[model samples]
Target: MRHITSALLLSGSLLSGSALAECQNTGNFQQWLNSFKHQATASGIPANLVNNALHNIQYDPSVIELDRSQNTVSQTFLQYAANKANSYRLTNGQRKMREDRPLFQRIERQFGVPAPVLTAYWALESDFGNVTGNVQTLRALATLAYDCRRGSFFHNELMHALRLIQRGDIKVPEMMGAWAGELGQLQFIPSSYNKHAVDYDGDGRRDLIHSRADALASAASLLRQYGWQSRQPWLVEVKVPVQMNWALARLGKKLPVAQWAKQGVTDVSGRPLRTSGNAALLLPMGRNGPAFLAYPNFDVMLRWNKSTVYSTSAAYLASRYAGAGQVRYGNAPIQVLSVAQVKQLQSKLRARGLRVTKIDGIIGEETRRAVRLVQQQMRLPADGYPDLTFFQKL
Candidate 1:
């Protein structure tokens, strides 16, 4: 996670909307901290534990700044995939899988999640625990909980962070992680840690920060809880026909493998697509970029990280580790829209009675859906992706 900024707070841009009305801290930090201490103690957290963990925890403005500065609007799916699922990660992930073959086998047999998928998450989340983070988890959670924006959400996370300590899952000093208070190699939030962390090493403590076995097993456990299907395909690169109705190429529109094969979709080798069950045509960078058939397991991946780009990258990385070849970037350099351009397009889309929740310069799911609606109305390829041409037409 990135550091937070204080300038954005001065403009009130960081603390707007209903978040301001719900759990917004209007008083001093000390007062808020004291009140939170009482609440924590009341919630069954030991008074000493609460005090020790929260003592001298000044509000971290940088945490809030980093939270507000997060922007994935400028990154295309290919660029993100290239950065995240690069050669280095692939090599290291393969090596890790080979090194820990026995552990992985055990985890897969018990959790029903493949080793490659867990390795991909391990590689992507913290580079296999090389760089978990350095932020003081409690302080960051306290800061975010005190802030007006997302205060209530972080407040609950703070409670869970304290709960982790109370349960002896981790020591207060060891509670260091991302700015969002996500702990461990998997970068699980405190709530997730409480819910899914396991003591795979059988050392009596669920130590995710230093225990690879625990972290990997915990990751698999989390995926299983999110409805991962055993021995099912998560993602498969495919060649989509150029002449088909592009509207069908959407993440929400799932069709059976045989149905997609009938519609002219094939594996990357140009062979007919053959797989059990249904899959969605995932054109993350639009029709002019790489394509994949996302299965139900892919949806389970989304439950881990909602970003389509990140989920797709993780799934593709897993496939690569499992012996799939490089993704084929479609012919032509796909045009991308700038953040400002995306905001303008969202404004135009919202004006036309489309359901765009916010024009915050992010090409999120709603924005993509709105763009697809416009493209369909204009008789263009409705791939649910925004490009310069689509923006110009709008």
Candidate 2:
């Protein structure tokens, strides 16, 4: 018997089909899963459920590779927005919105989330249900849960996936999803689906994969649960005055839209955003790139996807779907930073007495704030985006 430790197992769950070939050390992986089955049963998961789900599950090394290869700081917001909300995606999303108008409206009446935003999320996450990945959810979860790097998190997700199966929400054999066990066309992880999925089509099951109604309603329910406000704009592209105050470029400070108008923030067409409520300014790329006034609903979308790129892109796509034009941006070449490079940048910011709470090589809020301070000192727009020039100057 080959005794295997999870520490030796790789991370990464199959988000893509290519991960099938990535699983190595099958003997050790099987041994680990076998041992984990006992633990799963001890934790109250039925022994039959554990055996049925884990017996035939294979280890996926591609999941681990993809997980470890994630460079959170690699893509700039502008790049992400452009790619995710490209012309093809936008056009397809608009068609999806039009075709599903009645359904969307009905969801809105019940959930208070706009159709455009929901459609945008669908388009971004799974390309409007065209490509929901070909990985088995159970296999991915089993491999990820056994992998030591993210064992606890994936273990919980695996248990949730098992419960979803046991509860008959979906069949065990037919459970396919992203590499990381995100089920259905919306790419929801198992726990999210269990919590937010709804049987909107009235077929008696919350089928996020084959049922558009279920997926959209589930997404809307999640937004509504996260406090989505009806008919509120998530974001609006704005033109900042050249001689503006740089201090206000900091994120998370919500001032009234009227105040932003007073500060000379105008829409792309040189008009006020014409919206109510307080908003925060987001310079996705530095000042040289586009700016937007993010509303509270933007925070709701942020909860949907924590990445600034994902949130901003979803908002941008939603705005377009709602008859808004493309955002105006200057042509600036963005440099992709490796994890090591970002870690070095974090260290430099720390050396300069700036507070970068985590030197994790991820450009998080604290890192962005520190970057803004550096830009303010250098008189370089204070947008907080660490572009090529900013990095070179530093």
Candidate 3:
């Protein structure tokens, strides 16, 4: 899954009526399945394989319910980070690295991605593959493909899943994984499995579900494909000057490390910031919380999972696995906004002629940008974070 966090936050809105009529169905599931089978076979998938893979597939309403119930807005940065990068994960990740030293060294040399980064992802994505979800992959994909909200995306994923089955990578009955059609230890969706999966163990098939070598190596390969630089830093916990302009703390505003140092940014110990490349000052919980200098490789983490909370936690966890200490919280406690409050804040921003696409109560990138704009106008620290005080001002 390219953006696993975003994939879980799939919008619940239905497709346009014409589009819904073409794919969405409850009672007409059989007819839609037949049509999809015909299309699959016409696309050169062996007809018998298609039939066997999709046999006895029924519409799964539970998948739709789970999809609609997902929400990540209520979580504060600290709350989300603590949950994803807790001590349990850190310990297990270190152990995994030690257990597979030779394999990790080979992958690092070939793909330029550190073992800790892949280990952090594995720890978070599936708890070191202990809980890869019990949902039937074909059933979930078929049900989602027939749903109107994200039918086209899931439909394409379902087709790729069929191709995986045809390629002898996995048998139809053994294809069980996440509710979002993700498979294996790293929770790769069908398309990613087809694109970047590698048989590092030389086992003939790229089996991410059962083989640790394949899963870990494939994850490194995927990161390398997403522009992961060898021997480059992804994130560094830092201290930001209280008097500096908070508007500069944004993911898009990358400045040279020297420039940031000239502007009063420093390492956690108040030492000069020392790095060769540009880095953005990422204030995940605004100016009053833990801060970091996110390097170019950090953007690659975002490509893996769009949510800042997830990416930051994964990066931080990777850092801890590499022997970094605990993160230091800022002077004041961060005020987290509720979903209702965020909706109200979005409405207020809209009334002030700010560009907020939807009042979905989610603190996505767009909402954060609009919040920053409003903060800038009000002569407040424009850190792009929403809180009760910001809401009251709006």
lDDT of candidates 1 onward, in order: 0.83, 0.76, 0.83
Span of 10 residues, lowest total lDDT, candidate 1: 3-12
RMSD of each: 4.3, 6.3, 3.4
Best by lDDT: 3
Q: What does candidate 3's lDDT look like per residue over 1-394, in tens digits?
A: 2224332322223222223223345557788889999999999999999999999999998988776654443566787778777778877889999999999999999999998899988988888988787899999999988887787888888999999999999998789988888788988888889999999999899999999999999999988988999999999999888778788889999988888888788888998877768989998888888999999999999888766777888899999998888898975778888878888998888888888867766687778999999888888888999877888888
Report the number of backbone clashes for model 3: 1
Q: Give per-residue CA lDDT, model 1, range 211-276, as digits (tens).
A: 999999999998898899999999999998876778888888999888888888888889887786
lDDT of 1: 0.83
lDDT of predicted model 2: 0.76
Model 2, backbone clash pairs (residues 3+ apart or across chains), number: 7
Query: For all candidates, what are the clash counts?
Result: 5, 7, 1
Q: Give a tens-digit lDDT track for model 2, residues 128-243.
A: 88777788878888878877666777888888888887777898877987777777778788887888889999998888989999999998988898889887788888887765
Please give the distance, in angstroms, between residue 358's alpha carbon in candidate 1 and its true position after superposition: 3.1
Stretch of 10 with least lDDT, candidate 3: 9-18
